[model samples]
Target chain A: MTWHVVTGGAGFIGANLVRRLVQTGGRVVVVDDLSLGRREHLAGLADTLLLQLDAADAGALAAALRMVPDGPVEVWHLCANSDIQKGVTDPSVDLRATFLTTFAVLEVMRTRNWRRLHFASTSAVYGDHGTTAIHELTPTLPVSNYGAMKLASEAIIRAACETFLDSARVFRFPNVVGLPATHGAILDFTRRLIADPQRLAVLGNGMQQKAYLHVAELVDAMLFIRDHADGPHRIYNIGPEDAGIRISAIAEMVRSRVAPAAAIAYGTEARGWVGDVPRFRYDVSRLKALGWAPRLGSAQAVARAVDEIAQQEFCRYDA
Target chain B: MTWHVVTGGAGFIGANLVRRLVQTGGRVVVVDDLSLGRREHLAGLADTLLLQLDAADAGALAAALRMVPDGPVEVWHLCANSDIQKGVTDPSVDLRATFLTTFAVLEVMRTRNWRRLHFASTSAVYGDHGTTAIHELTPTLPVSNYGAMKLASEAIIRAACETFLDSARVFRFPNVVGLPATHGAILDFTRRLIADPQRLAVLGNGMQQKAYLHVAELVDAMLFIRDHADGPHRIYNIGPEDAGIRISAIAEMVRSRVAPAAAIAYGTEARGWVGDVPRFRYDVSRLKALGWAPRLGSAQAVARAVDEIAQQEFCRYDA
Candidate 1:
């Protein structure tokens, strides 16, 4: 039986991945700091194997792994200061949560070799270079501290990968949506409509566009790359089938889906909040060559996320 | 009547700046963990207000600030884990020390605004863009984790400036050399020559060209900028007249000055070390426009550094 360790186990993406692993009869271990990830998310599975502590502490991480009842032959290192937009106001908070956390995981893995590690990197790593379709080879010039730190961690991991690890795959994911626990543009619109059905306040001049990829599709792509590729080093872009969708269309889709009576309001500012990715379109031929395409397009993914966030009482659990 | 605080103030460049600050009749505050910085560097000015602590610790920095006899404060935030080639080997150590430490300073500064702060940035922030003349407006695309973290800190500082503190000045300096106690191309070459005086093992093919600035020139320009500029924001390049230099020439210079009799052995396998700045020079006409330039050219700076290092005993003092 295969054993898997998902670092951010109680969070939206990690929990879903844990459920998937459990359904497939794989032994799974989860380590969550619970700052953002809720303990209730992994309530029933507490006995299944959980570590309730910060992942940024390498010692704590090692101690948590030692407590795991079963061995984790493979690792999905998704624990990070995962919020890209959070760095604008307080970049240090983001660095501690994301960059230091990444470093900690790398350090832990340095001593303990694993079958593979699937990193949940974001396309935000590629900063504001108004490109139509960017590739893995495109030089990353991050406009935000979030992207800069993530890219910095990736560079460190490059050196770490030099060691004899089985494999390491860095998946530069597009805006991933569709989850058991939802909080994103889709969810925001759904909530805004719920609060005031007559008006929706969207940031920016409504020209911001972002690439969307379902979390399941992203996780699947990550697994596919890890299972197939024998790369000591691999950097792949995981994105949706469509190029991307404009912010205006997403707002409309959110309005129509949740509150048909609401009027969409654009925060006709020069741009979205500081550090918001204005344009995101990735060339995923690298992953496509490995025979894996996202099941849902950007629009479809947004719609799905809206439905889930509106229907599920996940927000109460998230906050 | 200037009381200037220099974090990492005991480091190579920091010490150099401290020297100039003292020479110009300025009261000084030096903050250094001495992980790399040496205590001996600040020997003569034991009574000049020095803080021998990690700048990353909020408590420590606060204590240091409070310890300082309050005067009109002007801080030169020159603290960082300053080594690009070494960071390629282990990126996280430096990133945490550099990025997190700066984060602490920014947070502290937010509470107690310095009359003005001058940030000592680096040309490494540009990374390996293969460009000859890099500018303040040049697109930053760093190839190493060291550069990445520095660039991230820059973004963080810039954002803070725009919103939190708009008066901070950023000086992206070229490869600064001259009587550094800790590390540099000159230090590395000196150590290599000492280790194997018969043959020196260079990093790359000795062809990695870069703009070199003397620390004396850098600090002088920084002080000049502090005295003159009164704008919403300031970002000026401080470097030598020669925008670029081949590593081969640097190797030759080191050999001649430190160990002429020692043979030169090059690590001629590649164009650069793991994270060496292969190419990309700086244009410091902005500093020149301010009527401040390095007194010595790249060669002169190298030769002078060699003379100083040769005269001084190795591992004798801190910095």
Candidate 2:
């Protein structure tokens, strides 16, 4: 029997990862601050197996790790502040919560000698890559504080893997959009549509494209990399082809799902905000070469995410 | 009469700036934690006033700033973890003390509505630019955690200037070597030679190259930029004309200053250590256009620094 440790497990992607890990029949322990990560997010899944500990607090994380039952521990490090647009408004929160907090988790894990680790990184680290298909080797120069912090975390993880932990796979997620997440462009649009019901307000021009992946596909790729890769540490840009999604389409989907007659209005800027990427198309052929193909392209994934997000909101109406 | 509020006033660059301010007959108020800064570093500079206060400690900084009753305050923000090499060995220290500390100071200034700010930045933000003449426009993708933190600080400064503060100047300094009262490469080498007097262990193959400017020239550039530039914000890379100094040459200069029999040893790597940049050059033509230049080239600066360091060390021995 093996025990899997997942930090930020009660987070959007973390909870989804937990659901997948549950199916695999491994003893699972989740560590979350319960600040952004909710108890209800991991509701039925918690049955003495879940360990709710703050990832940013090293003392709590160390104590939590010690509490792990006698088994082979495979850790998944996925905790961070995942909002880029908000970073422009207040970058201090992003740097402290993301960079400082990530450093804390890395140091703690290194002390515990957690050999196997999978890091859930973000595509924002690449910034605006000139609409080319960005790969793992792409020179990352982040334009925003959030992206900078994520890039810092990626570098720290890579260094830790090279020096301390031998097994580390860094996955740069391309817009992991799905249901009930507190924040996302899709959720943001859906909420606006539900409120206005007649006029849909959109940030940036609709031409701003990006690769969006469903939560399941993201977790699948993560698991595949964890189970498969050997030799030196791996850096994978996890994205699907059809490579970019149009914001207009997401708006339309949300409008139709919530308010059928809503008119979409653009802010006239080419990009969403100062920190938001206008377009990001990843060259994820590396992951495809590793025997994993996404079930949905960017458009399909965004559509699915829109429906899921709307349904979750509608569930609130029923409540 | 204009008052200069020099943050990190006890640090190397800050002390140099304070000296210049004092000489120019400007009212000066300095704030420093004296972490790496020394009281002796700013001794006998007869003009300006000094306050022992941590820039990051909000209550301390606020109380110190309140003590400035001379005129409207002008900020020269120079405090930081100055050594890039130390960043690799001690990242956590630099990360908190440099980046986070800088942010706190900026926040305090912002709250005070301080008009003019001069940020003392480093060229390390450019990372390994591969011997190219890096300009202010060069894309900053730092390799070391220290560089990343500095880059982060620069980003915040830029934002504060553009969005928060009205007038600000950012100085991206190269290795500003000088006959300072306190510690530096020259001082370190002299002390090491005096201690052993037989064998000198220099880090790297000693091929690392970087632009060097006497600290006075750097301060002069800052004064020039402050007097001329009129806009939301301006940034200039301050370096020498030939662009840089060779590390091997600096070693020989230090050896020449010491007993000649001392053999030099390399760390046996192309780089000094993990985060060391083996080759660096700068394009400081912008500051040159602003009508200020370095009085000494890299080797000359090193020789002068070596002599000053030797004299200082000899005095200490006599004491």
Candidate 3:
């Protein structure tokens, strides 16, 4: 039996991946600092070792890895600062949490002689390369400090895979939304509407479009790529095949759920904020060619997330 | 007059760039930690302000940038851990010297409103892509930690440029060899042969090929690109148009210069070390199209570097 180790395993995507792995009867070990991750997200999982240690700390990471039962180990490196908005305000958040976390994890894996590593990269690595569909090979000219940090981590992982690891896969994820949602447009809209229930403020012109992948489908694609791909180092863009939904559409869905009469006021610029890639498309034909596809497109995924988050928040409010 | 800030100005490439800027009557400020840089490299330079500070320290970098006279500042970011061999032993050296140095410099640039930045990137970012001719758009999959660090820095600079800076150019250098040589095969061979005239132990098969560019030509091309290129973000591969000379050929050239009868013993693998990218080619037509070309091919550059380093070492030996 193989032991799967996940960093940032209490966060949104990491927690979701842990649940999928547990359901398949695999021994799982999760390392999370809980800076942004919630413990309740990983609750009720049987036989899962949740080591509450900062993944950025070298000593703590090594000790946590040692705690796993001696067996074949595969690392799912999903640890990163989830707050892209904060990266705009303070770039150090991305540097210390995202890039440094990756560096610490890679160092541990190198010392422990781990064979395979799966990195959770982001679509932001492409920046706002106009409105063209971006492939895995698109020149990674990141616009934000968050994107830069992720790209830096990707470069390190690629180098380490060649020098030390047996194999590695880097998946560039687009706006992932689902249960236990930490941050994104859907959650932000839901919170804002629940507060005022009248005028909802929208960033940008609300015409900026992008794809969104559900956390469950993201994990499915990750496992599928890991099992099927034989290349020593593989870079795949993970997203839905259909065109992305506009911000206005996502905002409307959120409005319908929380406050249908809320008037939407738009920001001046096309971008939501500094370093925001307002409109871009993902060419995930590489992953599709590998016999994998997302069940929900961007609109459907965002709609589902809005309802789930609204219900979660409403229940908490009622209690 | 515009103020020119050169990071790692006491090192080989940075010193060369400083020399060029000084010749053209530009006010120059040099920042270097002297970890891998030599103070003597900038000795007797006219009116050049030298600040002995680590480029990786954000506060120190900000202070140094503040010290520059109020004027249009264009930063030439060339600071990096020059020793690739050290990276193989410890990856943190590259992480600090290369990536963190760039990050610190960029942060300071962003805060201080320094709009123009010229980054010293490398061909190592291409990794071991066989013998294919690489272009600016070639997939960056660095095989060594040094390469990874450089690539990571490039990603940060790109992001920073899009976010804050006016214009930026990333020059991907390939084996820049010339006077005041800090480290490379030429200088290493010259010292070894000078110490022991009879035997020379070489890493990898002698047939491992790579392109080389004279540092003078590299600086020339960099200035040329800075002046002529109009792209918002420019990435150019700076190298000789000719094919790379083999290690055995360069070794023979060094032996002929210093120790005529030295016997060369080759290593088993095709690469010099674990992170070595033994063979690759740079398609610098992007640069060539910009009305600039290498004055010396790889063979000529290597031969010239061998003579210059041998003379410098011989004078030291005599003293």
TM-score of chain B of each: 0.91, 0.94, 0.98
What TM-scores does chain A show, candidate by candidate in order?
A: 0.92, 0.95, 0.97
- Per-residue alpha-carbon lDDT of model 1 for A1-319, expressed as tens digits? 7778788887878887787777777778888887767766766652257778888888888877775444447777777665556776677666767677777877777656654677777787776668568888775656566766677666656645544345678888788787665357777777778778899988888888888877777777776787777657688888985768888998888777667888877887755877776877888888888888887888888777767766764355466
Question: How well does candidate 1 score on lDDT at residue B96?
Answer: 63
lDDT of 3 by residue, A1-319 (tens): 6789999899999999999888888778999888888899989998688888888888888986887765568899988887877887787888889999999998888888887899999999888877889998888889888898998999888878757888889989998988897788888898889899999999899988888888888989998998899878899999987669999999999999999999999888888888888887999988989999988988888888888989987887799
- Per-model TM-score, in order, reads 0.77, 0.83, 0.97
Candidate 1 clashing pairs? A81-A98, B37-B319, B38-B318, B38-B319, B39-B318, B198-B263, B200-B265, B206-B248
Ten-residue region with minimum lDDT total, candidate 3 chain B? B63-72
Per-residue error at B258 for model 1, in Å? 5.5
Model 2 agreement with the true structure over A193-277: per-residue lDDT tens digits? 7778899878887888778899888988998988887765678888897667788878887887889998888888988778677
Better of 2 and 3 by lDDT: 3
Clashing pairs in 3: none
How many Å off is the CA of B307 in candidate 1?
2.2
Q: Which candidate number maximizes DockQ?
A: 3
Provide the lDDT at B169 for model 2: 85
Residues B194-219 of candidate 1 have per-residue lDDT tens digits of 76778887767777777776677777
Instruction: Kindly list the per-residue Cα lDDT of model 3 for residues B235-308, writing each as its tens digit.
Output: 99999998799999999999999999999999889899878888978899999998999889899999988899
Fnat for each model: 0.10, 0.03, 0.72
